[model samples]
Target: MTELPPKPSRDELTERAARVRLLAFDVDGVLTDGGLYYGDGGEVMKRFDVKDGHGLVMARLAGLRTAILTARSSSIVEVRGRELGLAAVLQGRKNKAAGFRELLSQLEVSPEECAYMGDDVNDLGPLGMAGLSACPADAAAEVRQSVHYVARCRGGHGAARELVELCLRASGRWEATVQHMRDPDALQAVKL
Candidate 1:
């Protein structure tokens, strides 16, 4: 077996994260632990972490755009994206790099200002192109090796939250964002 490439140093990772204005995620392995469940009626079920949802909100509050790019189509993912107020939710995309490019163009964001979180081979193209990249602790070795940061938490267990927090902190927005979240008036000002 070949040795995996080393992760970037903390300072380097932080520097890259600080430049991010957009964050894109792969829905399965990066957000839902890569699990798939089906009911008798052929409905698909996926579990998502509330912390991750809050993290997306925090990113948006801090003036960052969030997007979901997934190969599989799921109504659950659509509802989740809406609930979290993500900028884009693109599904049924077999070629993720193309989808990612389309998302960037649609949002008018450059690749150097985007962060991507993924956990599988399908995620490699976007991850490699992103300004800052991250993966879950349980990600594939290749995926893990390619990213700048690997979260201690697994997917569906706050991994996405970890990535978002890293970027927020690096860019010096976390403190003010948290303060705003705590302010009842500030929270009430935003209509859900």
Candidate 2:
């Protein structure tokens, strides 16, 4: 097996993260532990972490656009996207690089302004194009090797939250976001 490059230092990550205006993610393994639960009627279900959901909210509050690109189509994903007020929720996009390009066009942001997190080989395209790439701890070997950052937490267990926090802190938006959480009116007073 070939050795991967060393992970970026905190300062390097912070510099890259500071330029991010959008936060994009892959659904399976990155957000939902790559599990597919089937019901008796053949319905599919997935588990999402509440903390991750809140992290998306925080990202939004901090003025970052959020999106999800998944190869599989699921109504659950749509619901979650809507609940989080995501700017985009693209599903059934097997060619993720194309999808990511479309997303960037739709949002009018450059690749250098986006931070992408993914977990498998399928996610490599967008991960390569993103300014700052990340993966969950449970990600595939190739994916972990490809990304700039790897969270300590596994998928569906605050991995997304960890990334969100890193972006917010790196960009110097976390303090105000926390203040806003403490007092909703506090956000209005602080300049982002």
Candidate 3:
């Protein structure tokens, strides 16, 4: 089959990214390091970057809905989603496109308002459908070429953090956000 037309301009992508109402990530690569370790207790150990978690919290505070959609079903992924108050946690989905459609319907958000982050072949289809698509630094060349933004950092490192950082900057809140993080204790007093 022939390829689609040339991708939208960076401005269009960034615009979509900035206006995103929903942000969904593929669990393994985008959230974790794409490596799974099995312990003797039959539990899984996945390494998640602290910076990424902070970015996620910031995004949520900014009123953006977040979610995790992955083909693998694991309690680890489930726990992480619950910890973050994700809008959705879809796992063991062989056809991600279907899951995405279901999510869009449930969230009542249009495709153009959704931003999807992923790193492998399984991610390409949903990535193409999203108005703004992104991939980690270690993603396959094909996935990188298909996405509008390719994070400068690798997965499970700071790739997800870079995505949210751009959104924060685009929204003109990066400086204040950094300061807030630095002085969270001082800021907390104002909340009461």
Report the lDDT tens digits of candidate 1 across residue range 87-181.
99999989999999999999999998999999998899998889888899999988988888889999888899898999999999999999989
Please provide, for model 3 over 1-192, each residue's C-alpha lDDT reduced to its tens digit, 9 standing for 90 to 100.
668456667677668777778888898888889899998998788988877877777777666788888999999888788777688999997788888888888899888888889999888878988877899999987888888888999998889878887777766767777776677674453311
Q: How far is candidate 3 from the true structure (C-alpha RMSD, Å)?
A: 3.2
Native-referenced Cα lDDT, model 3: 0.81
TM-score (all chains, Cα) for each model: 0.93, 0.93, 0.88
Which candidate leads the pack in lDDT?
2
**CA shift of 165, model 1, Å:** 0.5
What's the CA error at residue 150 for candidate 3, in Å? Answer: 0.4
**Model 1, which residues run further than 4 Å from truth?**
1-5, 188-192
Ten-residue segment with the worst summed lDDT in candidate 1? 183-192
Measured with C-alpha atoms, the lDDT of residue 161 in candidate 2 is 89
Per-candidate Cα lDDT values, in order, are: 0.89, 0.90, 0.81
Tell me how many residue pairs clash in candidate 3.
0
Model 3 residue 92 lDDT score: 93
